[model samples]
Structure formats: C-alpha cells, structure tokens
Target chain A: MGHGGGGALSGELTRHLFTPAYGNETLGGLGDSAVLPLPGARLAFSTDSFVVRPLFFPGGSIGDLAVNGTVNDLAMSGARAAYLSCAFILEEGVGLPVVGRIADAIGAAAAAAGVVIATGDTKVVEAGHGDGVYVNTSGIGLVPDGVDIRPQRAVPGDVVIVSGPIGLHGIAIMSVREGLEFGVEVESDTAPLGSLVEAMLAVTRDVHVLRDPTRGGLGTALNEIAAASGTGVALVERHVPVPEAVAGACGFLGLDPLYVANEGRLVAFVPRTEADAVLAAMRAHPLGTGAAVIGECVAEHPGMVVSRTGLGGTRVIDLPLGEQLPRIC
Target chain B: MGHGGGGALSGELTRHLFTPAYGNETLGGLGDSAVLPLPGARLAFSTDSFVVRPLFFPGGSIGDLAVNGTVNDLAMSGARAAYLSCAFILEEGVGLPVVGRIADAIGAAAAAAGVVIATGDTKVVEAGHGDGVYVNTSGIGLVPDGVDIRPQRAVPGDVVIVSGPIGLHGIAIMSVREGLEFGVEVESDTAPLGSLVEAMLAVTRDVHVLRDPTRGGLGTALNEIAAASGTGVALVERHVPVPEAVAGACGFLGLDPLYVANEGRLVAFVPRTEADAVLAAMRAHPLGTGAAVIGECVAEHPGMVVSRTGLGGTRVIDLPLGEQLPRIC
Candidate 1:
C-alpha cells in the first residue's frame, strides 16, 4: 500500500519504469518541474496530487497544500508561478459544504500566492471506491532568463543553506493521524515560498540549486542532490535548525528529524562567494526568518551525505527506504 | 456517485460552487480550456481526471483517454497542445505489470498526439481505500494568432458540424460493465483531435465554437453552447450520424444516443459562409471522415435546443440531469 513513498522503491519505479517509458530528455531530468522553451520565454511546468488523510490538519488543510505545493515546486525552479490548473476527485456521498470549504481554501491560497486558477476539472467516484477528496494541481510559471537552478548545479565549492526549520509538517500530520498530541501544538509550516525565492534571486541569479525538502524531507533531498551532481554533502548536525517542540515530538516518536517533511522550507545550494549575501536576502523575507547554513558540498565520497556529530564523530545519513509517514502532501 | 456527469448537476456544481469559489473571469468562462495571454503568445491550459472503472476498456484504456482528453480540450480552444503533465493515483497491491502497460500506453498516445509528457507524479493509497488507478492530465497549448474560439462565440446563423460518429464510447463501456452484448462489439472511438483541429483552422480561422462531446454527448454540448451564447439551436435529427450498431445497442439498453458519450468526435460551430469549406476540411482528416452538418444557431428561442424529428415533427432536446453511463470516459 505504500509503494509510492519517496525512497528507494520510488527511485526504482522512476528509473526502471517511468523514465524509460517516457523515453524523452525532458522527463529524464527528474527535476521538480520541467522547463520548456516557448517563442520568447521559458515556462516551468509541474504537477502534484495531494492525498493526505483527515482533509483538515494543523495550520493547513488539503486545500492549502494543494495550491502551495505546486506553487513551491515552481519556486524551486526559480520561476514565478503564474497559473494553476486544478482537478478534484471526490467520493460520491461527500457533502457539498465540505467541498465548498475546500474550494474556498484553494481560492484563498491561490490569491495569497498571487497565481490564478486558470482551469479546473471535477470527477466523482462511487461512494465506497474513493477517498473524500484528492486534489491534483499543475502549475505554469515564467522562468526568467539567466535564472538557472537545478539539482545538477550543486558543485563542491557550493554551500548548503536551508531556508528555515524542518520536520514540522511531517510531525504535524503524524500527530493528527496517530492521535498523539504533544503538550505544545506543532503547526505545519505550510506557507508559499515564491517571495522568498524571488528575494534570493534578487540578490543574485547564481543560486546553484533550490529544493523544497518534501516527502522524505531534507535528508532525501540532499541525497538526490548529491547523486544528481556526483558530489558528497557534509553537514554539521548542531547547525541544523530544529524547533524545540519538533525535536521533542520526533524524539518521543522515535523518528529522525532530518527525515521529516517540511512544506514551506527549502534547501538552497549557493556558491561560497554569494552565500553570505544570499543568506542576508533570505533572512529579510518573512518566511525565511530561521535561515541557516548547515552543510556544504564536498568532493569526497560522491553520492553520499555524512553529518558531523556533537562528539566529533561523523555518521552517514542514508536515504530512507520508505516514508516515515505515508499519504503526506 | 454520479455528481460529475457533464449534465445539469455538473453545471450547477460549476456555476454555484466552483466559479464563485474561484472568483475569477478565467475560470468563470467555464470553457473546455482557459486562454491566458503570455508575452508574445496566447497559452491554452486545461485539466481532466479519468476515473473510468476497469482501467482497460474495449478499444482504448484510461491511458489514451488521459492524454487525448486534455489534448482535445486545448484543441477546442483553437490551440495545438504542446506539453502535458500527468499524475497517477494507484491503489496499493495493484500489479506493476498493469501500471507498466498503462505507462507505455500513455507514452505512445502522447507521441502520437505530438505532445510531450514533460512532468508527472504518482501516489499510492491503501488497498481498499481507492480504485485501481486514477489519472489526471493537465495540458498547455499555444493558440494561433487571429484564431479565437469559445462557447460564447456561437452566434446566429452559425452552422454546426460534428466531426464523426457518437455514442460508441459510452456503449462500449456499458457493455463491459453490465455484461450485455448486442451481437456486435462497440469499440471506443478514442483518438487525438489536435491534427484534425489544425486541418480545420487551415481552411479558415472563423470557427466560432468548438467542443468535444465527451461525458453528456452531443445533446449537452449543444445545450451548453446555446446557453453560453444566448442563442437557439435547430437540428435535423436525420443528419446526425449514428452508427447502426450504436443505435441498436442504445435501443436495447433504453438509452438515448444523443446523451451517450464520445471520446474522439467534436462539434464545431462555424460561420455559414465558411461552413462548407470547414466541413470539407474536416472530412479530409483521418479522424473526421464521417463529418456532417447537424444543426445551426438561430436567433429565435434563445437558450434552447430543438431538433426536427425523423417523423416530420419538432421536439425539444433537454439537457440531461446526470450521466446515463457514469465514468464512460
């Protein structure tokens, strides 16, 4: 039931299944979005389907995730999301009021992100054959000239910087799914990151790579970057930003914080020369208040990620074999 | 369970729920696709989710429909689809070979349609919580300059031409679902209509309105045009092309052929002056060999559709309340 988790199985499905079936250079890139050239401009295209259970969650709902998820994908490509196409799959017996609430939330989220819902579709499945609501949003964004960002751009001299704290979104959904709430409520950090990406680009278009650490969290994203660029990543564990509440929840749940998901946060790889200036720019943005540099790309142990422990020892951070939490946005 | 049947219920959902929730003119248009003005180009964007039961139908599977449906939507907007983003929701325990077959079909269909499947996503749901597979495809196409086609452009004296036969797709699905046979197997007429649309445009750019009669077939599509343009439509029942097998099946099944779905055919409203040439152009295309002039827009009895009976009497054709065959496409 968990075949699509963002891990080794997912990687095998893509490599041996989807990529070969597509048989094209575009899909082979396997980036968050695909960049297509038009008459006088470049367009970034991306698609994501949200199937999170319990339609409503802490600080966000499926509606909010549906919009922000695609918007953030475009942002990671250094594009300004301009339009979104939404499709909803509803169970037959679901109430109209519930659908209305979701539609309103999607609309509000699009407005907040400054993107228009250009087109949409709806299909209803028989009552027992489907879940309450599943949303698939595909976005089109304009990629400005000279702004080239991809996982392959990470180089040995580049420094890795995460926009803010991690693991809140994964933990938040787990808390609701398992009915285990900590003393402090951990709200999902689900906010649009387009403006923050724009601020970083404003500082310089030389941002090597930008990725929203979703699904398998910062650890998987880093491993992907390392494998795609044929470089190793070295991280200082103490420098990684983790909220006190999130850390406590992860510890109690016997989960590693690095493998938890974050919706609004991003990991950026910038040249060492532009790291300080870019960090300043990210800090100035509202969504990047906790911006921190916790890692750097290295030439040793290619396609690997290792973190320095507090005891002056280093341990390899393996990419998760499957998701710690399934059905996450 | 049949809420999205492309009938009155679907219309109400869009008008009362979706449009108001979106609160944008782009979505309010409610056309098959939305046209957005890009720098130096007009982009047509559309989305559709295919949840047809028994993934593999008689002539085509959900994979072909997923590609061609969105391609046809963009074609209706006077655009040739250039790119598509596909997302799949698979139920847990589904066989990999089955998924592989669907993927290969999608790739082949996109290649045949001359559009690239640029990006995609896949998610898995628990075994009993979902159907076998649900596919959502969002497409982007570039609209040619000086060609503007929309539902509202169906003015008085516009001649309506249908590309080919109808009702085959719906009957084919019904036969499989209900295990009924009428001595003849009805194969679905699923094919990409982008090239056919291009051929029609080559004859003239004055095609006023274009729609693929999918879920609610020709009756509902004609009604939507009449309502959107505030014009009446008059049709000759004898002129509407229906295959002999499809007619027999519909009769035995107690269904109206006018309300049965078709996947490949399109109904085009063109200026009276250019109607003959456009019909000739359409007939020359492989997919539109059975093209016929079925009706014309009239100024009298606005927002209504009436057809001349084969028995020399006139009858009003009411829009269906819901699909006679759910998940036909």
Candidate 2:
C-alpha cells in the first residue's frame, strides 16, 4: 500500500523497480509528464488512475478527478491539454445508473476543461475482484514553443508560490470516510488548472518549475523539486495558507496541513525577478484567487527543505514514508 | 459481466451508455483507435486495460497483452505505434518480484515492437479490493500520410482475408484455468502485429479495413465491419484457419472456433483487385505465414454476416450475446 502513497516508498519503487525495468531517457527524467518532440510540435503526455474509496465526495467525484488530475499533470509542463483517453475497470454487479453518473461527470469535466475525450475502453471484473469502478485517464497536450518548465530547472534565488489553500481535499475525504466534521464543511478543491497555468505563462515563460501538490501535498512537492534540481528550499511556515475548517479538522485528526493532498492547487518556482508578475497574474484568475508566495529556493542544505516556524525555530520537512490517508485521490 | 464480453451486450453499452454520455464525433466513430489530425501529422490514439486472470499464461502474460493490445489497435489504423503510457493498479501484499517480472516483460515487449514506454503511473488498492494487478496501457502512433483504414470503409466488393489461426488464445487460457488438457499443450498466439500490418501496407495502401480479431474472434469482428459499412459478409467456413490442437479443444469444449478469441491474428478487408497481392505480402511475413482469404463483402443481406457451411448449407453468424470465456484477454 505504501508503494502507491506518493511518498518515499513510491519514489523507491520508481527508482529501483520501474526505472531499472524501463531504462529509457524520457522516463528517467521523472517529470510530472513526459514531453515528446513530434514533427512540428512538442507534446506532453501523462497518465493517472483514480481509486478513491467513495465514488462521490463533497465537491467532486472520481470522474472529475480523473480528468483534472491528468490535465494538471500536463499543465505542469506548460502544455494545454488537447485530448484524453479514458479507460474504466468496472465490477460485474455494479448498477448501470452508477456507471452512467460517472460518465456524465467525466463528460462535464472535459467540457469545462476545453478538452475532448478522444478514445476510451471498458473492462469488467467479477464482483469482489474490484471496487465499484476504477477510472484511468491519459492525456496529450501541446507545449507552446519557447515555454519550458521542469523540476530540474529549479535553481537558487527562485521564489516558490502556491495557488491556494491546502489540506481541504484530504480533510474533505477523511471527514466523510470517518463521519467527522468541523462546523463548516470542507469540500475538495478539485478544478481544472490549465487556464491558471496559462495565465502565469502569459506573464513570463521563464517559470523554472511547476508542480501540483497532489498526493503528498505542498511539503512533499517542494521536497521533490529540491531533490530533482539539487537545490534547497527555505519555507516560511506562517505564510502557507490553510483554511480554518481544514486546520480545525487536521488539529483533531492529528494531521499536518502541509502534508495533506490537494487536487486544484499548484506550486510554482519562478525566478525572483518574475515572481511578482507571475503572482499577480495567478491572482487575476478565478481558480488562483488565494495564491500566495510561501518560500524561496536557497543554495544552502542542497536537496533538503527547511522551514522557519512561527515559534522562531527551524525544522526540516521530510518526504512522508507512507500515506497518512490512503486512496484520497 | 456480459457488458465486457465484446458481443451484443458490449455493443449496447457503447451505444446507449457511452455514446450518449460522450456525444462527440471521434468517439461516435467507435473505431479501434481514434485518428486525430494534429498540426503536421495525423496521430492515432488508443487505450486498453488488461484484467486477465492468472497474470501469467502459457505463451504470454498480462504484461505482454497490455503492450500488444494497444499496439495492435493502433496498427489497425494503419499506424506504427510510436509511444505508449503504462499504468498499474496493484493489489496490496503482492510480491515485489512478481511486479519486477511483469515490468521486465513489458520492457522487452515494447523493445521488440519498436515503441517506447514514454510515461507511467502506479496505484495500490488495499487487499480484497482488487485482483493481484490490473494493467492499463494507452498508445500514440503517427498515421502515414496516404493510408486510411477504418471500419466504415469496407465496400461491397472488398475481399476478406485473415492473418493466421484463431481460437488458440481463448482455449489456451481455458486449458490452464479449468485444468483441462488436450494431447498436446496449446499455446496462446500472442505476438506483435505492427510489422505485419506495415508489410501489407507496403503491398497496397488501398486496404479498406484492418481489425485484430481479439475478444469475439473473427465472427464478431466481421459482424462489426458489416454493420459499420452497411454491407453483408459471405465467409467460406472451410477456408478459415484453425490449428489441430485448437480445433480438438473447441470440439471437446462445445465451442465454435469462429467465436473464440485470438491475440495475434488480424482480419483485413481489401479491394478485390488487390486481395491477391495483399495476401501474398501477408504470407511472406513471419507472423502471417498461415494467412488465407476466407470471405468477401456482399450486397445481399446488408449489415449481417452469413457463412457457407462445410455441408454446403448457408447460415447467419450472429454477434454473441455474452462471452463464452470471461477475461480471456
């Protein structure tokens, strides 16, 4: 189970298992998406499978996540998603209406994202051999010329900015799973971030690195960037955004807001000179209204992420060994 | 389970469930793979998920099926596969070595097919929630400029030819699954068909249709083409190739060889004038040595497939309502 947690175990599986087996340069880069140079265009490709426990969540369902997750992966590479291929693994006894609802949600999500479901496949497993349904979506996007974004491009003097509040999506799923709730309901912030990324790129194409803080949240995403680029990340803990409902829920649940998963948010590492312009452009978009600068890339303590606490002490934020919440996305 | 049977139930699901939900031109076409016109090239994209039981089979495993299935789909579009993205949904508690062997198979299969595994993803489901593993592969291929192959292009004057033997894959899996044995062990005819398709195209780009008779075998594939092209098919029952072991197994199992599944064979609809040349080209390829012309498209009885019996009688071959063997792919 830890191998799917998107943490240290997941990283090890890719390094020791997948990379050794695959032995390819494109996959060796370990980016959020693989960019292939075609005849006249460079295309970004990515894939993700959603096995969340509950079929439907507070603000979203697995259907929407299937679309947005891959779309966000392509956006991280500075690409506008153009087409998606969807495949479903359905349990035998599941009702047709349930499958219908999920398909409807997928249709709506693709429409909202301005992408087409170009191809699809479906398979059924005998009951008890599968959850109700599992959806896998793979996307292809066009990378505009002169725009380059990758984890390895992060360098010293880069400013780190997050699109919005964290921990809501993780806490939202947990609240329903465990039947616990704060005074205000926390909804999964699942939405397409392609336009938000395009807005930032419009300001400048010099964005060094862009990653969506998904399974292991903002803290783990920063750690990955630091390691991939061989630079250090210095964070101001107080500047990180956490909604009151999410914070209250995490407090009772004994969870850290920084390590919770988010579906709709992204962490961008831009050159210090372009940081202000990028932040302003992000704020101008509807999905990035809560955007804030939370950290900076530093030359000290390369490959590590250290945070300055509100209590005037510093602590290292390590990659999580396993998931605190499994199957949240 | 019948919904995944590649028969009548599967067609209804696609027509009433998927088509209404998706409501797009490319998806409505319902080709084995979708051909998208990009800036400088037309690309073919396809996706498939492998949930075959007993991960390891006689001649191939789910790993090779995951690669070859999607690759064959792209090949049916007259495109040589360029790249594939693989995703795995693993059940908790499966051994690492098992995953390693499967990954090695995928790597070797991709290398043999002349395609690259460009990107991948993995997710783990808790024990009892899934089978040992389910693999999903999505592929992208570049379509040649002057070659156009699709189901609806099968004209009445087209001649039908099959690449090789049928019923071997389905019977091989059944022999292992049910603990039944014939005098000689039957092996799955699982092999990549991209090179064979290219060879036939070299003979004639005027080939109208090409489909890998996978799940529902030759009987169902011809029905689909007949329905799609609004034509009738006349098959000579004696001319369709079936190996001795496969024929013996199907006879004892009370199954018709026409409806049994095949992995490596293809059914092509070529113009009557070019059929001889294409058949010659197919016979020259390693994978198509057993190729034979079995039938022809007809103007009588549109949208149906009728076969001439070995007894000199004629009968309609209906699309199967449900799977005779489940999860054979």
What is the iRMS for every candidate structure? Answer: 0.9, 0.7
Per-prediction backbone clash count:
0, 0
Clashes by residue pair, model 2? none
lDDT of 1 by residue, B202-289 (tens): 9998899999999999999999999999999999989999999899999998999999999999999999999999999998999999
TM-score of chain A, model 1? 0.99
Highest-scoring model, DockQ: 2
Q: On residues B1-329, what C-alpha lDDT tens digit does candidate 2 reach at each position?
A: 99898999999988898778777888877889999988999999999999988799899999889999999999999999998999999999999999999999999889889988999999999998888989999999999989999999998889999999898899989999998999898888888899999999998889899999888888999999999999999999999999999899999999999999898999999999999999999999999999999999999999999999999999999999988898988
RMSD values, in order shown = 0.9, 0.8
- The local distance difference test score of model 1 is 0.92
DockQ for all models: 0.82, 0.86
- lDDT of every model, 2 decimals: 0.92, 0.93
| Tens digit of per-residue lDDT, candidate 1, span A1-329 | 44677877788887898778777898877889999988989999999999998899998999999999999999999999999998999998999999999999999999999999999988988877778999999999999889999999999989999999999999899999899879988889998899999999999999999999999999999999998999899999899999998999999999999989999999999999999999999998999989999999999989899999999999999988878888988
Residues A178-280, candidate 2: write the lDDT tens digits.
9986988889999999999999999999999999999999988999999999999999999999999988998999999999999999999999999999999
